[model samples]
Target: MLHSSHEPTDYQCPFCELLNDQPFSPDNLCAPSDLIYRTPLVAAIMACDGFGNYGGHVMIIPTAHLEALYDLDEQTGSAIMWETKRVALAMKLAWNPAGTSTRQHNEPAGNQHVWHYHQHVFPRYADDELYRQLRHRVSVEDRARKALELRSALFSAEHPYRLTDTDVVR
Candidate 1:
């Protein structure tokens, strides 16, 4: 068990509730690809509530149930960041976003609605309202397709990029 004072005794953490269940609700889970990216200590999946920006938006979460960043383990933290960067990179490559944004909220005062610690990675567009953008509710099938696309983008980006004075190629 995660040795954290913030662990909820009243109700289960929604992320922990995922427990790799059948992703029927696209907003709560991914149908086809549950976790697009997974390391030993963490997992990255398309958040069901990515209404703010692009299709490839995702959340990087620790596999264990930790309430806040302070409660997160070093190894889990590293794994989360690694997956976050990969997802952001893949979003850039696949979606051609104007930019990328990463957000993490802590505690009620900090607007952290969920108790589980996670990082949000979204593809920023020129007109995106950032925190003010209205989140679009998407379907499970659509999200699954997007997840597949992100995986492909990450796979394609896996190769090294070498630059020449005249040209750039892998």
Candidate 2:
């Protein structure tokens, strides 16, 4: 097992709670409907916070409770990268943004709020200034709607987003 650098002793991981299909916290805005793609090893959900004009960004997380990248296994990491690409492509089909970018934080100094390992996928537009913008909370309703839109693109026949049992991490 890998040691965690920043997880608190009494941490209640919001991502784990969300995966369990329960309210992660009072401030949690994620719901089952926000889940766009899920496999036994990885899942992608719509974020409840958006930066600047980009609402409904995607967060790809490992199903297990690995605290950070230092603790992630190769199998789970591969699954995440696969899902990340699929979600990014789906965002293009769903929103047609200028481009998309991915971000991840590890320790508190790195600005990681959640203890669980996760990667953020943002839809970037011209002059979006994503790094400079403050993240604002997104409504559950809007997140669910965006999840549906992205899910449609993710599962469309033109795209090979579906993961079969063979795709599972061994």
User: Which ranges in model 2 have alpha carbons more than 4 Å from their true place?
Assistant: 1-3, 160-170
Error of 1 at 114 (Å): 1.7
lDDT to native, each model: 0.69, 0.83
Point out the worst 10-residue segment of candidate 1 by lDDT.
161-170
lDDT of 2 by residue, 1-170 (tens): 44546777877777888887765777455676777767889988899898876677999999999988898789999989989999898888889999999999988888888888889999899967788867798888999999999878876776667544464432
Kindly list the per-residue Cα lDDT of model 1 for residues 26-116, writing each as its tens digit. Answer: 3334343546755557766777665555444788888787788888778888877877777788877777888888999887777777778
**For candidate 1, what is the lDDT?**
0.69
Candidate number achieving the greatest TM-score relative to the actual structure: 2
Give me the runs in candidate 1 sitting further than 4 Å from their true place.
Answer: 1-10, 20-34, 52-56, 157-170
TM-score of model 1 relative to the true fold? 0.77
TM-score of 2: 0.89
RMSD to native for every prediction?
6.9, 2.9
